[model samples]
Target: MNLRQFEVFHAIMRTGTVTGAARLLNVTQPSVSTVLKHLEAQLRFRLFNRIGGRLQPTPEAQALLPDIDAVFSRLAAVQRLTQDLAGGRLGTLSVAAAFPIANGYMARAVASFLTGRPGMRMALQSLTTPQVVDRVASREVELGVVHEPVGSTEVDTELLLRSALAAVLPATHPLARLERIPLAALEDHPVITYLPQNLFRFHVDKALAEAGISPRIVAQVTVSLTGIMLARHGAGIALVEPLMLRSLDFPGLVARPLDPPVAFETVLIRPRGTPDSTVLARFVAHLRDVLRAEGLLPEGH
Candidate 1:
């Protein structure tokens, strides 16, 4: 029998009356009766018996109830899953981000995004900018967040924000008393910063060159997080991006803007032709809200 006929027969067996079946199926009683008749004709067996103005399930109906119940149970589950998917409440997301972004703002964004999404499982990986770009290009991750420019033509990039580099120093350090640290002031003091090969270092070097002093480089770190940590523990002063520093709580450290602010672009990258899903769209909106609250986005954004 077709699905409609099976549905009507199952509903009649469930409530044991055509009137109840019609109400359950949102159909007229006559339509329900007609479907049951058609189903019986197809099956070559009566599914119900009329007794004293009431309907009773036939022996054949009693035997088929278990299978019909299972079918409807599965259909009910499918509907619930469909609703959850449409609502952006169910899915798996894979994301890769640069070390600083992961340790700072993206961490906060994920916590907020997953607040009520019990069905959305996610993976957040920390990688360098090149690694982040590679992951997105190869489709190993759905999205990548990094503070450096990505030259890959395999992905689409969107600049999220431009953030300034600041000097982080131990609270007890001499530079800590200054509201803004000039690059020249750091010339004689030991500094912990990006490796010369890194893209972020390019901006810092150019800014320092304009100040006409070479930084006294003691240690070079790949991630801003490492430099910040080092500076917190009486290490050399750190010149690094401040995006991740917004949420930091290093009791012994304070971050001061450079006299000439050095800025870098933070971008979100995705595979070129990737189609958007409801869950991904929801997460992007949630992420922007987090950035706005972090003061990383325009107030009206």
Candidate 2:
């Protein structure tokens, strides 16, 4: 029998009479009787018996009651789950981000997001710019944060923040005396920064090439935080975006805006045509607020 027939059968079994089943289902008694007759005809057996004007379930109807109850139980669970998702009360959000954002602002933003979201879960992974793009485009991660100007056009991208590179140096370094360090000044000292494969490294290379200057290369690191740490130990000067500074707590390190600023953009990405979940959308909103307050996100956001 169909779902409606099963529903009518279940109601009749529960109340044990056509009049009571009609009342429970908010239908006329004659309508309930007609539906029950059709249901028994489809089943090719008698499901109920009318004796002394009282309806009694047959052995077969009693045997089928458990399965019908299970169906209703599962349906009720789906309804509850749907309500939770629509109300933003429960869901898991998976996000992939470049190292700087994952360690810095996103870490704090996630802590703040979990304050009252007891049933919500969040997974944050640190990856390179290209890896972030790949994960988002492949639908492996619902959201991505990375350095802007992503190479691929398969994902939807939005500028999340705009900030210039910062010059990180040892507290005792000579450039620490300058409010803004010029790129040419770095020529005198070894530079510890990202490896060439990184997207941001391309910009650093272009800027140096345009100036017709070659800075001493001390170390090639994977992320800005690593470069900053090395600079704190007097390895060399480190040039990094400002967001990277938020994750560091080196008391012996100093930061200055690069002169003739080398600006950069942070982008938010998602797989093309993938709809945003309520939980994901809420967390993204929270992230933007935190970045804006930290002065990472641009104004008029």
Candidate 3:
């Protein structure tokens, strides 16, 4: 009828005698007898026959043993799986991120993390800033990395890095000769930019607006990689973060710092009330170390 009764029945079937079953179960003989009687009553079928002061398993008990053993085996597997997860020995991490961090920073960080911790697995989803926030808020992802400033009270964010934005231009472009491209110089050029909905796009637009310059929008792309490709083909200059610049090896594109440089802040976000697991914390640390080693993070940060 229940797990305990099934266990008692199994013990009695294996040992044949009530006293032996009681010893196997670490229970009194009377308790074992009581459980067997209750189980037989609930099932409306006798599981064993009493003969010569011993339990002789019935045909029904023999038929049921295989099914009961299977159930116990599955339950044992489930218990082992939970124990592995709790010990941080085996698990999957679901991570979401905006374009730059997803493709640039987190990709490499995840690689290094997995290399060091082979028992762990990760699933990465690339999304826009809004999507990252939504995934984290909905509990679809365990963690997120994004460029936008997260203001949700239901999420906790930690600043990871403030990377300087670079002006990516075609190799032959005259502005490419300068050590840095001033915002004013880009006023007349068609600007191949990220989609307006993206965080970096918002930052670039605001910076240009503050500088009294409105960029001529030549093309808008959803991904930073697309923006880079467009810039390489001479579509127009693109304002992208330094990490994205490093990731691309476009032959015709050169990345130069923006004059009076605008930097975008990268933040690690998690649900407000949830504590980060050991695996997640180790992953965050790996990310910070990678960024710092690559000269993306602020000094001593």
Better of 1 and 3 by lDDT: 1
lDDT of 1: 0.85
Per-residue CA lDDT of model 3 for 177-278, tens digit only, reads: 999899989999888776776667777888898889987988988777877888888788888665676775677778888877887777888988899887
lDDT for residue 21 in candidate 2, whole number 0-100: 88
Per-residue lDDT tens digits of candidate 1, residues 1-301? 6778769877877787889899999989999877777778888988778998778888888898888888889999999999999888899988889887898888998888888889889999999899999999999999899876688899998887877899998878888899988888998899899998788899988898899998678889988888988887767999987656677777767899999888778888999988777888888888889889877799765
RMSD of 1: 2.6
Quote each prediction's TM-score. Answer: 0.87, 0.71, 0.67
The true-versus-predicted C-alpha distance at residue 227 of model 3, in Å, is 1.6
Q: Candidate 2's residue-wise lDDT over 93-187, tens digit each?
A: 88988888898888898888888778888899999889999999999999999887787878998878777878888768788999988888888
lDDT-based ranking, best first? 1, 2, 3
**Whose TM-score is greatest here?**
1
Candidate 2, poorest ten consecutive residues by summed lDDT? 240-249
Clashing residue pairs in candidate 1, if any?
A: none
The lDDT of each candidate is 0.85, 0.84, 0.82
How much does each candidate deviate from the true structure in C-alpha RMSD?
2.6, 5.3, 7.2
- Let me know the TM-score candidate 1 reaches against the reference structure: 0.87
lDDT of 2 at 154: 82
